[model samples]
Target: MKHPVTPDGRYFAVRCRLWRMVNPDLDEAERSKLTKRLMVARRAVRDAKAARDPEAEAVAHRAVDVAKRALGERGPVWWKDGSPDLNRRIAKNTPYADWYAQVTRSRHGGS
Candidate 1:
């Protein structure tokens, strides 16, 4: 299922917390490439953990970070509006609090 994105399109909410969205400005091809890289790196991480290889796990984690940064999901905020990066913040405690509340209310039939 799709998660709820903030109105400004910079983040999507999962379990009432915000996670930064990818840079929308990236061309589709570039985005796809980075996403694939991220998947591969993620699998590497899993494999390293299962194999109990700490060195390999560290390398894989670095790879994942690189891909995520390239995709604009980590590092710096993709948005240029000067809004602080709220990545991983609880939505209800941030500026998006009212908006998130409204969304959840509507989703639950205005509970």
Candidate 2:
């Protein structure tokens, strides 16, 4: 769950994208809380890197990961009974190959 070192702007962009994906009707307070946590995590990452401390960097990475998970990224899907997560694996390599192809075709009109 360690994210590679990147520009602070990149982290902000990610946070923005995740925020956009959240339910629009979600409680404002809850959304603000998650956004704050994400900012803290990103800062930890930046600070740890500046200090050039590997252990602190790892911890910071974990913090970023934890924040992302809480924000419904890179962890369990928030939606109940949603389709199984295939991660980044190719559909043809998993049992959902056929189903994946069918879904893609329907969604993208087979491009």
Candidate 3:
């Protein structure tokens, strides 16, 4: 849970890639509910893959997508600032590149 977040807080870095943060505007209960749905859908995807059921996997993937979108992690940008969505982009390739470099240098103890 201790991932580096972009300065604007719009995304978090994981494995050096950016993933959009969930909508902070969502009420606590709504966000929790959507998060639960996402967990369930992700589990379904795992099950489908283990069972070698391609059709079921596809369905589960769609469920995951829907849940993510509802949580504002996908689809339309949640922030109204007109900034481009950087979901899934490598941090080093984004405007966050300099910040990311600084963070890595600090964490790894470099000048």
Candidate 4:
């Protein structure tokens, strides 16, 4: 299937995956916080792409810092990596593992 794209042509699937990795539970508070960071990052990336501006790219870098901090406070292990292999390992062994595994599997149609 063709992936959804933003009006500017950025891939929605990539954005969705990044958003999910940053905040998976759909928690209102968490989503709000990440949304703020993501906005900043998106603006930075957009500006950089438009004008090749290093300063604008820095904003996106800062946004990533904010995201790391937020993700870190929730759990030490959760901040390591957001890849499926790592997430699967954490989910299989941690308290929230079962739910995480189920959700990820269901989303990807994997067993």
Q: Report every candidate's CA lDDT.
A: 0.94, 0.56, 0.94, 0.49
Question: For model 4, how does the per-residue alpha-carbon lDDT over 33-76 read when each residue is reduced to its tens digit?
Answer: 77787677777778786898888778777776666547442223
lDDT accuracy of residue 36 in candidate 3: 98
Instruction: Write model 3 residue lDDT over 51-102, tens digit each, in one string.
Output: 9999999999999999999999999999998999999999999999999998
TM-score of each: 0.95, 0.53, 0.95, 0.40
Sort by TM-score, top down from the best:
3, 1, 2, 4
Model 2 TM-score, all chains together: 0.53
Instruction: Kindly indicate the candidate among 1 and 4 with the higher TM-score.
Output: 1
Please say which candidate is ahead in lDDT: 1 or 2. Answer: 1
Candidate 1 whole-model C-alpha lDDT, 0 to 1: 0.94
Q: Is candidate 2 or candidate 3 better by lDDT?
A: 3
Question: Which structure among the candidates has the greatest TM-score?
Answer: 3
lDDT of 3 at 22: 95
Instruction: Summarize candidate 2's per-residue lDDT along 35-111 as a digit string, tens digits.
Output: 79888988988998999988998998998888777766557655566655444455455554555455556655784
Which regions of candidate 2 deviate over 4 angstroms? 1-20, 23-26, 86-111
Top lDDT model: 3
lDDT of 1 by residue, 52-102 (tens): 999999999999999999999899888878889989999999999999999
C-alpha root-mean-square deviation, each candidate: 1.1, 9.7, 0.9, 10.1
